[model samples]
Target: MNDKNHKVYLHKKKYTRDKMKDYTFLLPAGLFLTVFLVYPIFYNIILSFRDINIGNLIQGEQPFIGFENYQTVLSDPLFRTALTNSIIFTLATIIFSTSIGFAFALFFNKKFPGHKWMRSILLIAWMTPIIIIGTVFSWMLSGDNGIINELFISLGVMSEPIYWLTDTDTALLGTIIANVWISIPFSMVILLSGLQGLPTGIYEAAKIDGATRFQQFRHITLPLMKPTILVLLMLGVIFTFKVFDLIYIMTAGGPADATQVIPFLAYQLSFGMYRFGEGAALSNISFLIIGAIAVLYLYLIRKEEVM
Candidate 1:
């Protein structure tokens, strides 16, 4: 009995020591998250519920305003337009970018001359600064003296120059085109990596069995790539949802608010309009939407793992 008790005591002590060591490893990240991520999230939540303003900050007293800010935001037409645009932008980006990326990945997965160099060139768009891309695209898409219109006129594609940025119908599409150009490279790289990591033996076996390329891809490749596809889709959705810089630089959400997105709307409320509480509320709303998406993704991933 005494010997058994001593062994139990030793085991308990070892378990406690292991827990302490694990905590030590977690300390740095835990501290950083508390200071930066956690605090800001809570502070933003608090601000959303208050009557904070630029002047209030200088006065150092932000009175509680209950749900007034949220009510105002909900009643705003600009907010509705911004929300619609954000949804449309995100969905279009995910569909087009993922499809094009997958196609490119399939193409580049084959043995071809200059494939590596082609891939490197494609990645330049992804690696370049978003601001620079937005600025350059804005210049090229300009109405009268822009290179795009000039080339189109020279090629007899258009008799007169089209106003790409100023037109309400075309302005948003222009931003989408620029966004797609920058986004496809990222999707390609992810899908390409996934393609390379697929098991070669499966393809070889399929070939030995006299399987057609399309049939093999349908039965084998797609099933193997489902997980990667899910990840890429989620990433694309998240990236496009938060898009602000490109829209801001290109159109300033102008031409009658055609290209206004949630982030830009939030920025307008906070800085441009000096409505801090409303801006915070918009941010919180955006956070809730994104958080719900993240949670759904995590739940799906866990379910997949279990299956």
Candidate 2:
């Protein structure tokens, strides 16, 4: 009886040890995610439903306000303008950044003299601090004595210096240009990695079969790179949608609310205007938009895999 009992006890201990080993691998990540990611998300959701403000924040009396803040944000003209600008900014960034990045990937993927140096230089824009980029671009696009205007004038392209960031019509465009400059490098790096990962034999086979470069790119390259391209597109849309620093630093969302995006609008509502509830509502809305895009991207990815 003692021998039998000893063997059973040792087996139970081994079983418990194996279970612990399985959980050990997941413990750290689970803890980190719960603390950092899950907590903030839940807190933000709670804040969005509350009438939180500076005073209430200090007093810890953040009471719920239902959907009143959301209604106010939806009805506001300023919010409408911000929504429009955000859509435009997101669309333009997606088009220009993705296209330019793909072009650069093609260029950089080839073995050429100083290719490494060229790639390093291109990545400088990505590596530079956003605040510095914003400040330098603001100075360069200044209406009066900006380098861009001076260059255009010297080249006789306009026959005069153009006020790039002063007019409402041009202000948003100027911000987009600055954003594109920063974003292109990211897209290029991602696409370049995808390009490099592609099997070379496929291209060689296509070439041997009398396929032209354009045909190969259209049929082979594009299809093969679809997953990577989708990821970049989704990321570009999300990043561009949340653009705040560049617009805030460059235009403060205006010459006349021309460059205001959802994030900037939320900032103004919360900090600048002291409407914390409305700011939270706007933030929630932005989150919804981005969340929707992410879901769509996931669906597409899954569908592609299924096909």
Candidate 3:
């Protein structure tokens, strides 16, 4: 070959080798997703369209029933209740957690003695295992001789102990309280980062213009933290919606299904009652809802980048 042609050929070969090396580095991650994430997702979707119960899981033909499983799940009143409860639980937890977290973030943003240690100490609740938190909250909220009841009685706030976990009226509320407590630390850290990222110059300018602290926060802080707030809320919704361990440890979806959410309902159907098809369908429903939120989150991220 001519010298120039040989040189061009060698350059192309080097580029191809480099590209191949990059792809080779991605093999482990690709295999992991395909085997664990992608395969399970597709399997669940296919299973949702089948009549796969314990009776037919092993030998008998697991017939493809198309949308029958979805139909059954959609038609169930308990499914509706579970959906409603999921919404309530997710929304309430996000609202309370974000609010309290923002307050904590603001408080800690100011430099003070022992502030760093205090902030780190608060994260212990968040870093602790969810199961442990659930168990602790369960004990604290117990009706008979629980610390909460004892404290309330001593304070003359109540003459009798409230069955926080066993009574249907208060069961969901009890779970929400636990979840909010667990979520606060995450929210606080996220908002604290956002707060610290704000331009100090803008606040100084606002102060020079006779702006009050509340006014500066409303005009300068909120607008600057919009992206952070949006991302935090989206993540909170995604995580809180799929919560099962806390519910399982705290109430077990008891007190007449008062605390039943989608994840717990799916667990009950599949493992507890052996209704695998319905369970898969319920799971797919949850997946779709979360997927939509994930899509929205991506869109916002792309928009921010474009801006």
Question: How many backbone clashes are present in model 1?
Answer: 0
Off by over 4 Å in 1: 1-22, 302-307
Rank the models by TM-score, top first.
Answer: 3, 2, 1
For residues 38-88, write the lDDT of model 3, one tens digit per residue.
Answer: 999999998999998888998877999999999999999999989999999
Worst 10 residues of 2 by lDDT: 40-49
Q: What local distance difference test score does each model get?
A: 0.91, 0.91, 0.95
User: RMSD per prediction, one decimal?
Assistant: 2.6, 2.3, 1.4
Residues 1-307, model 2: lDDT tens digits: 5999999999999999999999999999999999998897777777778888888889989888899889989999988899999999989988998999999999999999999999999999999998999999999988789999998888888876768888888898899999999999999999999999999999999999999999999999999999999999998988889988888789898887878889999999889877788887899899999999999999999999999
Q: How many angstroms is residue 246 displaced in model 3 relative to the true structure, after the best TM-score fit?
A: 0.5
- Model 3: which ten-residue window has the lowest total lDDT? 52-61
Best-matching candidate per lDDT: 3
State the lDDT of candidate 1 residue by residue for 1-307, as single tens digits: 5999999999999999999999999999999999999999899889899998889888989999899999999899998999999998888888888889899999999889999999899999999999999999988999978899999999999999878988998888888889999999999999999999999998999999999999998999898898888888888888899999999999999899999999999999999988999999999999888888888888878888888
Candidate 3 structure lDDT: 0.95
